[model samples]
Target: AQSVAQPEDQVNVAEGNPLTVKCTYSVSGNPYLFWYVQYPNRGLQFLLKYITGDNLVKGSYGFEAEFNKSQTSFHLKKPSALVSDSALYFCAAVDNYGQNFVFGPGTRLSVLP
Candidate 1:
């Protein structure tokens, strides 16, 4: 079984400051991790992914995630937060045998200006 965990329900960060959203996963084998963002009343948009290679992976909109195999964690990071960056973020694990992906509950980020 593959699953993802998002420990926080919401995160608050000031504009121009760095922001981080945490995630952890459990899978049968090597995991394919992904990050996605969803705006209000909108569908989720792919932010980044970690298939293989370096532990550090960068993705869209100045977002990056570090894959820690030992910890089974893939935490998302942004160098500078923006008011517009406030949204719902999700962490997902791709099933190795199928095209299905199991997503985390979600983490809402609120950026204050």
Candidate 2:
């Protein structure tokens, strides 16, 4: 079965500090990974995706991720986190044989000022 797991309920970070929300996925074949962010009462906004090639993928809000095949993990990262970065983060995966995607419950990133 294809699934995405976000082990953390939330990540607390101070302004200008680095922050990370954990994510791991499982699929039958190759993985098409994506990240999204959501603000209060707003639709989710796309961040990045890992389809093929380089494991290091960058996205909006100065975010990036490293796709690891062996571990089946795609962890989002940032050099420095901003207070505005506080929001809900979700990791998603497209089914190898199915077009629909599976999403993690979501990790709330709290970037304190």
Candidate 3:
């Protein structure tokens, strides 16, 4: 079985400050990791993904994540956060086998002015 975890239930950041949301995973082999953001009453929106090549993967909304094989972690990061960035973030993983897609509980990000 493959699983993902977002240790923080919520993350608070000041507008224009750098922000990060932690994520760790467990899987049999190399896993395909993903990050998604959900706004109020909206479906999850794709943020970024790590499949094979590069360790650092960049995605929409000025978001990026680094795939750390040693730590089994893929934490989402942004150089500067905005109040509009406030939303629920989720980390997900699919094993190399591609049999299952598991999602983290989700971490709420609040960017204050």
Q: Which candidate is the best by lDDT?
A: 3
lDDT of 1 by residue, 1-113 (tens): 67899999999999999999999998767889999999999999999999989999999999999999999999999999999999999999975665558999999999999
lDDT string for model 2 (1-113, tens) is 67899999989998888887889998778889999999999999999999999999999979999999999999999989998898999999996566768999999999989
Clashes by residue pair, model 3: none
Highest TM-score model number: 3
lDDT of 3 by residue, 51-77 (tens): 999999999989999999999999999
Estimate TM-scores for all models. Answer: 0.95, 0.95, 0.98
Clashing pairs in 2: none
TM-score, prediction 1: 0.95
Q: What is residue 12's positional error in candidate 2, in angstroms?
A: 0.3
Model 2 — which ten-residue stretch has the worst lDDT? 93-102
Which regions in candidate 2 have their CA more than 4 angstroms from the true location?
Answer: none
Better of 1 and 3 by lDDT: 3
Reference-based TM-score, model 3: 0.98
Q: How accurate is candidate 3 locally (lDDT)?
A: 0.96
lDDT of 1: 0.95
